[model samples]
Target chain A: MKDALAHTHARIQPYVHNTPVLTSHLLDELAGATLYFKCENFQRMGAFKMRGAVNAIMQLSVEEQQSGVVTHSSGNFAQALALAARSLGVAAYIVMPSNAPRVKKEAVLAYGGQVVECAPTLTAREQAAQQIVEERGATFIHPSNDLNVILGQGTAATELLAVQPALDYIFTPVGGGGLVAGTILAAQYFGRNCRVVAGEPATMNDAYRSWQSGTIEGNDAGDTIADGLKTQLGDINFPIIQQGIDAIILVSEDEIVAAMRLIWERMKIVVEASSAVALAALLKEKTRYAGKRIGIILSGGNVDLSKLPF
Target chain B: MKDALAHTHARIQPYVHNTPVLTSHLLDELAGATLYFKCENFQRMGAFKMRGAVNAIMQLSVEEQQSGVVTHSSGNFAQALALAARSLGVAAYIVMPSNAPRVKKEAVLAYGGQVVECAPTLTAREQAAQQIVEERGATFIHPSNDLNVILGQGTAATELLAVQPALDYIFTPVGGGGLVAGTILAAQYFGRNCRVVAGEPATMNDAYRSWQSGTIEGNDAGDTIADGLKTQLGDINFPIIQQGIDAIILVSEDEIVAAMRLIWERMKIVVEASSAVALAALLKEKTRYAGKRIGIILSGGNVDLSKLPF
Candidate 1:
């Protein structure tokens, strides 16, 4: 797995940015811990999703590359895959929900992806993407379930650890389980006793429930402000998370909004509510991590301006 | 002047952030120029005003320092001075207009500065500040006109030129002319034929008209969306601007808003409308800078979230 992450990092090196690590004195004072934010929000497609997308498309064989790739995503992955495919000279088919934001759809189109709208449901999206794979003989890439994608996602943590390897804990927002799983792998290989933790929105605490039950669980209501963490874990990455994750911290919607506002106001950086879940989790248990060095993965900066909670 | 600027940089080195220079491929393609944005918005107190505030306060004699510093400002400078003074262990007396945003006032208070409210007019603000200076025996630091302040502000461009010396032009927003004056001096001393340009709001085109007439001028009405650039240039900095500024570009309110939105979406950074004026000017004349390398100073990022134009 470590070797796969290294290979993925090498493959995607030319395509993505080694995004900066930012620190805030105010945030550190508030949390009673020194925090290093791995700013993946400044990543190529404005999200860490770019890392997984690039690696997945680049892993295709020459024959498969000729046929191109396809994915179903209503968030950053849709744009990420389109951009990665376009940059690598491959055609991309994006299966987007019909009710997705107009701005997001336009962004995918601008990146030269062929958008195929489906009914706004997971089953419908998967069926639409499966049809594209069959008709075009293209490869279908899962946003977070594929092994290659998980390896790619792990590279962000790998990079963060490369800079600051002595961190006591690393927190990541868990949605499809790909990022957290990859982060755990990277921390296991690269970090010196660094424990991996997951941050989940209270409204969508499927990952938390799954951690306790030792099985996959679905959310009763995915009505969280942290839109990126609304999805349930998949079987492919669930085992990795179970073996490596130390704990799952659940943060309320109000905490997520407050954390987002803090980053925007204090750091003067634009980050989505989903990214704030990780920081909110740390704030929720500041005493446990006091005087410790921690790393946080700021997932993305894609947000609808009109819908700003503040 | 160069020696003074170098000294100022050293004095304020520990107090301010060496903010990152960000580049957007999409913005470069749109403007037909490679643009490097010197992000002063990420500076202490969320503005480049911190540079001047630190230098101005630090230069005081021990007796003057004991007496403290006083300034009249309703913008980023107020918070910048407050934070700078608090960091340096000096008392700060800030005279703010009552019409200033509640967020700005609260930020000043949070930074431990003593705020004295006055009527919403320049005359009242100055009178209030004057009373404080006289009664408290505090030193008054003009936001833009002070020599130390101008030298401090120049360090931003000095840092920018240190990183990229071959830039063809450097653009800065013009308000009281302090930033543009300092930037022009920095370019003159350090750059390789880099012309300094000023971006002014079209509705408040005092700087543009002043540059044309070779004399100071005042705006008929300061009705621009860029609130920070509404103030007219002062005599102390106006001559410096007249001597060194190569051009002054005027942009409409709509153009400013469009530029601001583009930055927020594409760059994934939270920059106030005032900082967007420089980019709007460059975008307005893309044809003039085709394939050229340009540097722009993003002056500040302190904004009231509730009144966001977008």
Candidate 2:
């Protein structure tokens, strides 16, 4: 896995930026820790999802590449896959939810990808994507279940620790467990004293419960503003997280909103709701992070600004 | 002055972030050039002004430091100076224009500075600041006129070219001419290949005319949404700018607003109106930058979000 991450890093070096890390005295005081924010929001596709997508796309054989790649996403993954495929000169078919933001759709189109929209349900989207894969003879790329994807996602943390070597802990928001699992693996392999912790919204705390019970817990039918975190944990990602993670903490919606507003107002950085969940946990004084050099992976920055008020 | 910039960079290395220079393919395509955006919005105090404030404050002798510092500004410089002074355990007095944004005034107060609001006229603000400095026997730190401030401001460009070594041209919005002159020195001293250019709104073209002729031109009344750039070029900055600056491009007020919207929508980065002046120059397709590796210093990120619709 470490070798795969190293290979991905080298391959994607020319294509993607090593997005900047930012620190704030106000944010540090609020979080009760000296926080280092790894701003993946500034990534090429405006999210860390590109790391996984690039890894998967680059590893494909000539025949597989010619056949094209496809994936279903609420937003970020679709844009990442589309942009990555475009950079590699491969055809991409992105299945997105009909309710996805217009900006996300525009980004995928701007990258020259064919978009297929389905009903908002995950099962409906998957079924639609599967049909497209069969009809077009395209490869269906799972967002998190693939080993290459997980290995590639791990590189963010690896690169972070390389630059900011003094980190004592890492906090990342868990959606489908891909980022958290990859981050944990990277921290375990690269950082000697760093602890890997996952943050999730209480409204969508399946990953938190799954980690606690040693079983895959089903999400209830409640909705969360963190749209990226609504998905179920992948099989490949779950075991890696189970092995490498220190703990998972859940935050309230209000906390998420407060943290999001704080970053926007004070740090002057636009971060989506899921990324805010990690900050929310820390701001709410989640134990194990006090008086330490804590690194937070700001997962994405694809927010509908019209939806947020100052 | 160049030697002072080198010293300032070394002294403030631990306090400030060497912000990244980001390349935008979309922006580059629009401008018909390769654009390197030196993102000082990510700098401490959410602007490049901190570099100057930190440098100016740090260079003060023990006796002078005890008496503290005074500055007059209605924008980023005030907040930056106040914050830098607070961090150094020194007092700061700021005299702001009566019409200054409430948010900016609040920020200075948040940093534990004494703020005195006077008439909106430049003369009135200076008079108020001078009175305070005289009464308290405080060192008056001119935001853009002082040698130390210029040296500190130059560090942005120095750090910029360190990461992105191949720029052929650089564009920065001109206000009091401090940023342009400082960047000019940095580019000349470090990366001699790069031609430093300044961008100013047609409404505030004193620096443009100053670069054209051998003397600084005063504006009777400069009107623009870029309040920070509406000020006349400083005496110390004018001579340096006249020598090193290749050209000064004029952008319209409407163009400035358009550039501001584009930055917010495409980059997902919040920038104040002053920063938009540089982008406006590029979007207008100015001849000097066509097909060139152009570096643009995004001056600040202190927008009043409540007034903006997304």
Candidate 3:
């Protein structure tokens, strides 16, 4: 999987920015570790999801390109797929939950995506996406679940270790499990002996439960400020994650808020609540990775200041 | 000045992180121009002032180093000087205006500087600093006036252009003009024909007036949320700025606040009001550099979130 991801990196090189890495002295002291932050917040469409979306789009058959691609997401993936489709000169249709952030929908539309609003329920979103695929004959790019997307997203960790080869641990926020699986694959390929840990919100602890049970677990999806982490792990994503991921840690909403503010104040980086989930795990000192070289994936920076969680 | 700054860069390289340059697709679209943001917000003391302070402290003679250094600043320079001195194993005495933000004062103290709280008036701050210099045999490191300090500050622009040579224009928030002068010197050395513009708050338009008159102008201490830019330019800094700087543009307080929020929201980088001054200028759509490659010096990210400007 990691070798495939390294191959995908070459395929997606022209499409994505080699987003710069940043470090902070104050954050280092506070965290009690040397931290190299891979800033994916600077990625096209303002998140790392573009890597996977573009990778998946690029691999489709010429006939598939003619038919266009579709995805169901109200967050980063929707914008990623829309912008990737635009870049590839292909059509993109996105089915978004009606209750999704207005900013997310506007971004997708601004990027030339044909948006279809569905009910907030997952079933409705899936059904709407299916209908769009059936009617338009477009290929659906699952936000997670799919192997191509997961491998594509894992290149972030691959690139990190390429730059800072001595990294000891990689902390990432886990939601649908694609990001974690990708990270794990990269670490294994590099033979870095790097611990792969997931920072998840206590409100949405399906990933944590799934890791413990060795099977996909669905919990009551409670509301969290980290809206991106609300989804449960998929069947395909679950198995790879179970094999590769080392641990899952849960942080409370307040911890996420504090970590977000801490990054804003001390690290001087604007990270979304979902991105802050990893920082929250570090700040909570949930599982000690102190004195190690910690690499944090700052997932995205598309936050609404007008309605900040804190 | 450029040669002197090059010396500073060599001297200070060991202490400071060559802070990463961050780019934003969202910011580019909003400004209708490409932006390369040299993120000094990630510097040692969370600002570019560390570059200047470290160079100045390191260049001190043995006797002066043993005697320590003194300065009066109510902003980022205070913590920068403190941190630089501590890193160099030299003592720092910071005379801060009593009305300075509590967080700023605490940062100075936390960095191992002895803080002397004086009247908020400039005269009182100077008097307190002089008294300390006489009593403690400490050398005064002027915030912007000293040749060594300005030369040290110039290294920031030199480093920036080294990383981004194609910048067509460089925008920097003006306080006492040391940082801008340094940038101008660097641009000249790098064969960059880019205009060097200063971002100043409308309420504190002394720099703007000075640029127009071709002479230093004084303004009554004006209240601005960008507390760092409230001071007038210095004697040594004024001449260099007059000869080299392209223009000084004014940004309204509302624009400053808006830019600050926009940076936090869109760029996912936390910047102080002073740092946002350049962004505010861009938001105002100042002519002469439209559709050009603009490099903005995000001076620092030291805002106290407890009392957010908004």
Candidate 4:
């Protein structure tokens, strides 16, 4: 698993950006911690999803690559996979809900992916993607559940640790749990002393409940601005998270927006509410991490300009 | 003037950030030109005015520095001077109109500046600043007119050139004319063949009119999203600009907002409408510079979140 991340980083190196790590003095003061932000917002396709997508597509056999890859994602992963597949000269079939935003569909199309529309339901999306695997002989790449994707996603924290090895803690937003699981492995392998923490939206606190219950928990309230973290923890990544994650912080809707605004206003970086969840978690427990060195993976910076929270 | 800028860069190096130069391949492809953005929005106080502010204060004699500095600005410069003065252990008395936003005043105060409020008029702001200089024996630093300040602003271009010395053109937003004027000098000295272009709001075409008339001009309408570029060119920088600038482009309010949105959406960077003006100019004339390598001074990234144009 440790070698997998290093190999993944090397494989994805030719494609994705080694996004810059930035620090803001004011943000440090606000959090009461010396913070290093892994700016994955500037990643290819505007998110860290590219890291995983690039590694996933590049790992396929030549025959599988020719058959192409498929995934069901309405968020950053869809664009990430599309761009990654195109760069690898592989056709990508993206299963998106029929109600997905026009812009998102266009983005996938612009990246040369074939968008397969399905009923706006989890089962329907799964079935549609499975149909692509059955009919087109395409490999179905789970956005978070796949081991290769998890290893690739872990490289964000690996890169951060490489840049700031003295980090006392690494914080990530928990969604389908790939990022958090990968970060956990990265911190454990590279950081040695650094602990991994995860942040989840209060409304959709499935990750938080799952951590406490020692089982995957489901939440009905997908009513959060962090659209990226609404998904529940996946089976493959959840066990790793349970073993390695030091803590999980749940932040309110207001906290998420406020933190997002802070990053936008003070740090002068456009980060999605999902990215803000990590900072909001740190800020919520500022006293706990006071004077400590922390690293936060700013997952993505994609936002609809027409719908700013502030 | 070339020696002055080099000296200003060194003197202010300790107090100010040598900000990064960033490039977006997506943005470059959109504009049909390779664009290098000098990210001054990340400078202390979230603007390039920090460069000028630090330079102006550092040039003062020890006795004069102890007496402190006075400036009349309700914008980034107010906070810039405040932070610069506080960094150098000098007092900053900022004269702002009473009608200035409470947030702006609070920012100056947060940076350890004493705000002197007068009536909402240019005459009143000037009078209040003059009063401070008279009563406190403080040195009055004209935000853009001072030679040291203009030289300081030139360092932004100098740093950009140091990173990418083969730039064909440099664009800057023209306001009180300091940045454009300084960029003109930097390009002339450091970039032998690079031409300086200026961008201004079409509604406030004072700089454009001044360029055509060979004399200063003023416009009554300040109805534009680019608040930073509203001020007309001053005498000191205007002469340098007249002698050095190659072209000035006028952009509409829609164009400004659109350019700003492109930066936020594509680049994932928080930049004010003022900073977008330079990109707006290039985009407006994209066909003209199809494959040219251009350097744009992203002037600032201080935007009111509550009052976002998009």
- lDDT of candidates 1 onward, in order: 0.92, 0.84, 0.86, 0.93
Candidates sorted by DockQ, best first: 4, 1, 3, 2
- Cα deviation of A212 in candidate 1 (Å)? 1.4
Best prediction by DockQ = 4
By lDDT, the best candidate is 4
lDDT of 3 by residue, B66-181 (tens): 99999999788889999999999999999999888787788899999999999998899999999989999999998887767787777777888898898888899998888988
Report the interface RMSD that candidate 4 achieves against the true structure, in angstroms. 0.6
Q: Write the per-residue lDDT of candidate 4 for residues B1-310, one digit (tens) a residue.
A: 6787788778888888888898998899999999999999999899999999998998899999999999999999999999999999999999999999999999999999999989999988889989999999999999899888999999999999989899999999999999998899899999959999999899998999999999999877677889987788888999999999999999999999999999999889999999999999999999988999999999999999999988
List candidate 4 stretches off by more than 4 Å: none
The predictions' CA RMSDs to the true structure, in order, are 1.4, 3.4, 2.3, 0.9
Task: State the C-alpha RMSD over the true interface residues for candidate 2, after superposing those residues.
Answer: 1.9
Per-residue C-alpha lDDT of model 1 across residues A136-178, encoded as one tens digit per residue: 9989999999888898999999999999989999999999998
- Writing each residue's lDDT as its tens digit, candidate 4 over A185-244 gives 999888959999988998999999999999999987568999998788888999999999
Ranking by TM-score: 4, 1, 3, 2
What's the CA error at residue A59 for candidate 4, in Å? 1.5
Whichever of 2 and 3 has more lDDT, that candidate is: 3
Candidate 2 structure quality by residue, lDDT tens digits, A1-310: 6676677778877777788888888888777789999988888878899998888888889888998999998578888999999999999998888998787788899988989889998798889989988888788888887877887788788889988887988989998877888898888877878888888989988998898888888899877888889987878899988888887888988888888878877787788888888888777664557789999999988877677735
Here the TM-score of candidate 2's chain B is 0.94
- Per-model chain B TM-scores are 0.98, 0.94, 0.95, 0.99
Worst 10 residues of 1 chain A by lDDT: A1-10
DockQ of each: 0.85, 0.44, 0.67, 0.94
